[model samples]
Target: MTSIVTIARLGAQADGIADAPGGQIFVPFTLPGERVNVAVSGKKADIVALLDPSPLRVTPPCRHFGDCGGCSIQHLEQQAYRDWKRQNLIDALRARGIEIEVDALVECPPHSRRRAALTARKTEKGLLLGFNAALSHRIVDLEECPVMLPSIVEQLDMLRGLGLLVAQTKEPFRMAVTQSASGLDVATDDSGALEGPARQAAVEYCIANGIARLSVDGEIIVEPKKPVIMIDGVAVIPPPGAFLQAVENAEHVMAKLVVEHLRKAKRVADLFSGIGTFALRLARQSEVHAAEGDAPALAALDRGFRYGDGLKRVTIEKRDLFRRPLTYKELDLKFDGLVFDPPRAGAEDQARQIARSTVQRVAAVSCNPITLARDLSILIEGGYVLKRVVPVDQFLWSSHLETVALLEKPKKRR
Candidate 1:
């Protein structure tokens, strides 16, 4: 049935939500205040006609905006788009009973995403390669992706050719590509067995195309050059399919915030430090102890620290922080400051320890606002003062935000 409804707000997935008589309806590629005539089914609706269009809705830049799931809010005006993104952080914190001021959302421009996980499939006709469609398994064959680096987008044909070379199954597999300092680093998963002639072909194609490295299922196929990503002039080789900040500019912004915030500390504990993005930079001023679970990442960080000169004493420990977070007794009085950048599930256990410890300064970097708010509340309850929260737009046009928060504990009142 076709029904008209005015969008009340944007949901967490950036979908427009309308308060209907039954309940709420979600419409993709829509904006608030727009009266849309939608074909209703269950709780989902498809816009058949626009009775009224929102002023904030503008022309999306990319032709693949609606089809490609990589970006969501491209149709929104720039200022309004940013406000909505920033409000996510504010609202998340407020829900945790901590009303704090949040900085403006950091701008991430087009062609800035350094890493992407794309889908590839081989059929009887030919090879198919691109990002998966929104909430679907179907892959949208890419002529171009505005969010990725031009170098990566321009070489789509070459990637497709390479995909044809290594595709072992008819079902779609994954290829994670990252733009490194040397060249493009590509890694694929579920690429069955490539041996003898097939292996030789894959290796030759990568070398011929000047790919920095190519790996399948965590096994290196060809490494013409070690994939290097420079962090504050310190070049660190990232392990195969390792996690690094998605955008270079956003990483630098977060790192600068961390480094400046903990500059005065003589000793700093860098927790969940992957490839020493912040630890290596922080070592220029402070003695650093970086801990992480990934052995390869920690090894690469160790190599970077050992080779780099003019940095203070730097150390690395391979440990699962989630399983065994540093306790308050272990953290107390050992470091003046601490910096932690955990995965999407924010550091709850570690935050509890930091709350109880005597660490004077803390910088918490997070990609999820709800979990960040939960962890920050723990610290706030333990007497740590929430100073400033800056939201970085690493994942542009998406619901995700990278935030760097600075907190401090006052000295004894006596």
Candidate 2:
């Protein structure tokens, strides 16, 4: 049944929430204080009509805005959008009792995302290629995605050709296409096996299109050129399907904050350092000891350093930080400052270890706010003074925010 309700607030995922009869209703595409006529079913809602629209709502840039699921808040105005993203970070820090003022949201441009994580499936009609719809398995076949680099969007036809030739499963599979300095690096997962004549056709397609590399199920089919991503003028070739920051602009912004914070330190330890995104850049000034579990990533980091000139001495360690965090003893005298950018789980065990260490400056770079808050709280409990944090909106229109937080552990009594 359709019902009129006033949105109370935005949920963590940017869904509009309303107090309903039993508990609450979540409606997408609605902003707080907007009275919407929604079709209510259980705890879910679909906008039948907007009884009252929030002034914050504006005309979304793309025609696929509501359906693509690549962006959530495109309808929101620019300043209000920035404020909402920044407020989320502030609220997360406040929950941890670290009430320092967070810097304004570092707004990334619409077409700056270098990485596009999409879903694709082959249908009788043709091949479906795009991101999955929000909170559903259904794919929204994209005509255009404003958030991704035009370099990637322009090559979608080529990607679709590969999908048509190689896709063996009717079910949707992951299609990750990253625009690197070299060319478009493509990887697919769970798309069934590619063998026989289909494989040959796919290879031919990549060669003809000047695709840098193509990998399916982590196995490289062809690497025409080394997929190199420039890190502040330094070149680093990552392994196939490796994880890097999604936005180049955001990566640079975060790196600047980290490097400046640890500039005074002669030596720095970079933990969870994948492909030396920060460690390689940090080596421009400070000697860096980079630790990460991915062997290929570490090797890439080492190679990038050796090939590039004028960097300080750099070392690499291959260890799972999640399983075996660096102990306080190892961390104490090894480095003057430390920077860690872990996966979404947020390095709790590692954070606890860092809290016990005597490292003077700590830079915590995280993508998830909840886990970041928890980890920051642990450091605070160990007497680290929370300085300030800057929120980076690399994932434009999405709920995700990249944050850089600086902390300091006071010197012990002499």
TM for every model, in the order presented, reads: 0.98, 0.97
User: Tell me, what's the RMSD of every candidate?
Assistant: 1.1, 1.2
- Candidate 1 C-alpha error for residue 309, in Å: 1.2
> How many clashes in each structure?
0, 0
Candidate 2 lDDT at 264 equals 94
Model 2 misplacement above 4 A: none
Candidate 2 residues 111-198, lDDT tens each?
A: 8889888899999988889987877898988888888999988878778888988799998989888998889999999888999998
Writing each residue's lDDT as its tens digit, candidate 1 over 1-414 gives 999999999987899999999999999989999999999999999889988999898999888888988888899999999999999899999999988879988898989899999998997767778888888999888888878999899999999989888987888999999999999999999978778898999999999999999999989999999888998888898889999899999998998999999999999999999999999999999999999999999999999998898999998889899999988887885899999999999899999999999899999999999999999999999999999999999898999889999999998787
Off by over 4 Å in 1: none
Instruction: Name the lDDT of candidate 1.
Output: 0.92
Best by lDDT: 1
